[model samples]
Target: MDIKPLLLASGMIAATALAGCSTVGGSVYTASYASITDAGYKLPAIPVSKVPEQYRRQIVSYETKEKPGTVIVDTTSKFLYFVMPEGKAMRYGIGVGKEGFEWSGTARVAMKREWPVWTPPAPMIRRRPELAVYRGGMQPGLQNPLGARALYLYKGGRDTGYRLHGTPEWWSIGKAMSSGCIRLLNQDIMDLYDRVEVGAKVIVK
Candidate 1:
């Protein structure tokens, strides 16, 4: 079977739904996410020991219908819930679209990448040509724009150009930022990525 058509459909659905809707303060600080070469970029040193051991442990919330293999990003609460079976969800802090980019809808995980590359869209480059430097792709690591992982969103089966990925700017959590992508802490994203498989259902609300 031809998967291209199916993939495209899913991408479109994901894009349409996952696109952000709520903006925090109607202020977009572009400089906060200015471009930086991967070589020069680094994740702020964090004391893993200091990171609450409980938070590191998967959280099972009875209120959520999430299963062990699914992903849900609740922008309202600034939480990303990875559903574990028996009405449990592993929740993580998230940074959503600031304002104009905020969106709430349902989607699916069409694909995923580890240490994915960064390719700012043409418009993004147009708005800030400095992004033109990393057109094709970048290496995955502390410097990579996609952080530690990227869970590509889809609707019926098409590319929405939206993603749930990690960011070096851990402080950005709970804020509306990014061109339109859902950003999460590197460690948190890595953990979620490991638990989700391709084609997993994603609900963004």
Candidate 2:
């Protein structure tokens, strides 16, 4: 009956029920999500028990007409799928735009960066003045919102100012919390950064 749809509509209940729905072997998930040393920072390992099974990265049967290497972000479901051959995909949990910031559209990965600098957009700075200090851009580091990797999104060669990036706030997954960009676990994003190339298609829905 697709109860997950209804559960997702109720955040509190969904958190409990979804956590009980499915699970993975500790060894496998633990290994895949182990701490990483990137650009001189030690990314901590994820606490597998705190991550719901549905949100963990895994391969699943995905029926999509999109070609392999395409990226699809289902914001409502907090999932990002990387399409693969044979109607399959590597799905990762994501944090989407919160409230008024929600957005949807198709774009192309215009660029990819590791430990990228972060500069809050003008509007965002106007809303949160403290970010104004970063008008010149925040240096990349563990505390950077872009985390370990970032894939800049553009449409028709115009920068959309959106990105598929990593976040240190791992607990934000499966929730709507970002300003507009899609965020994944640092571990997951580092892995994805290696797989996706600049110019790949990205569909946000």
Candidate 3:
């Protein structure tokens, strides 16, 4: 007539089930931490702390027809998912373009750079004449708008004039800012830059 053993077994089963659900739903998470020293300036590793919990990098269970290694960006949600096998993805928070600068299309990563120089396109300078000083090109440094890395996007062997790049402005994640290019926290973009290869598929929608 002892019921304690049965109750204990049921509790164990329930706990196990909860753990599995958490893993499948991609609720368990951790933040990235790394010291970034570049261009004579050491950037303190605080991006993880600055970001919201929902925007932190984590493995997520994503349902998509796209193949693994593909980068799918959901601007509406300000999330970028790097597709993986078994319906999983490494998702990160992103800063998308504002209303008029928004763009959606498929492209491939044509190039990758570390501490890339920033050249304000003529049009961009025209919009803000103060940027004229950098008209030739801004040297790569911590203060450069491109931040620590850049992934140039191209379509059909043509430059899209858009990029998936890093920003020192970690606070901008999960917002509609930027001219048109997709932006990520410096630490997050560094992680993404390592995983993504040139010629990888990218879908922004």
Candidate 4:
């Protein structure tokens, strides 16, 4: 056997594995660039090409009894789905709460806001004094933790202190890193914000 042939085979195998690591599915590639907007405040427009293929917004075959317009969050899989008729859904990747902060329940979107303000809760401020500066509420802008939009969650007519909101940290789209809120990429959340209504149902599991 020629040693050169064996060396070429090994190189080919290594190259195949490296390429697979960068892809979410067969023939689908992640996005490479994004656009930014400066309408009053700087806002980012995430390119569909920059987002991973699986995370990009798409209509998918989903089985659920929930009516169209309902939002379902599957924390384990890091996906959020907006149910539609005919067994379909608009699915987007999400960033969920960290280990001990995870929650599951039914709630309703009680309010919606664009470029929402963020106020560090008392407990959170106590845990990290640096957050105390935002106790009165941080102004809405690119650096705001709430990003470009927010849908406030409520249960039994009371605020749950949980939210479905956008994040400036686009890289966190498929991770478990939020305090307790359900987070989406800024562009995705902006799209979701337009479709979801104040009285729409939300299921988190």
Q: Enumerate residue pairs that collide in model 4.
A: 31-49, 31-50
What TM-score does structure 2 among the candidates reach? 0.85
Q: Mark the regions of model 3 whose C-alpha exceeds 4 Å error after superposition.
A: 1-29, 38-41
TM-score of each: 0.71, 0.85, 0.83, 0.81
Residue range 21-88, candidate 2, lDDT tens digits:
32323211222676778778999988867988788887777899899999999998899999988877
For each candidate, what is the lDDT? Answer: 0.70, 0.86, 0.85, 0.83
**Weakest 10 consecutive residues of candidate 3 by summed lDDT:** 18-27
Give the distance in Å from residue 200's predicted Cα in candidate 3 to where it truly belongs.
0.5
User: Candidate 1: where is the Cα deviation over 4 Å?
Assistant: 1-58, 65-68
Candidate with maximal TM-score: 2
Model 3 C-alpha lDDT per residue in residues 1-205, reported as the tens digit of each score? 9999999979866764543322445354444445757656676676454567778777888999999989999999999999989889988889999889999999999999998999988889989999999988899877789988999999999999999998888889999989999998888888899999999999999
lDDT of 1 by residue, 1-205 (tens): 9999999978765653442122223421110122323334555643434443323324544465455677777787777887776666666777888778777777888888877888888887898988888888666678676897899988877777889999877667777887778988776776688888898888888
Identify the superior model by lDDT, candidate 3 or candidate 4: 3
Error of 1 at 50 (Å): 9.4
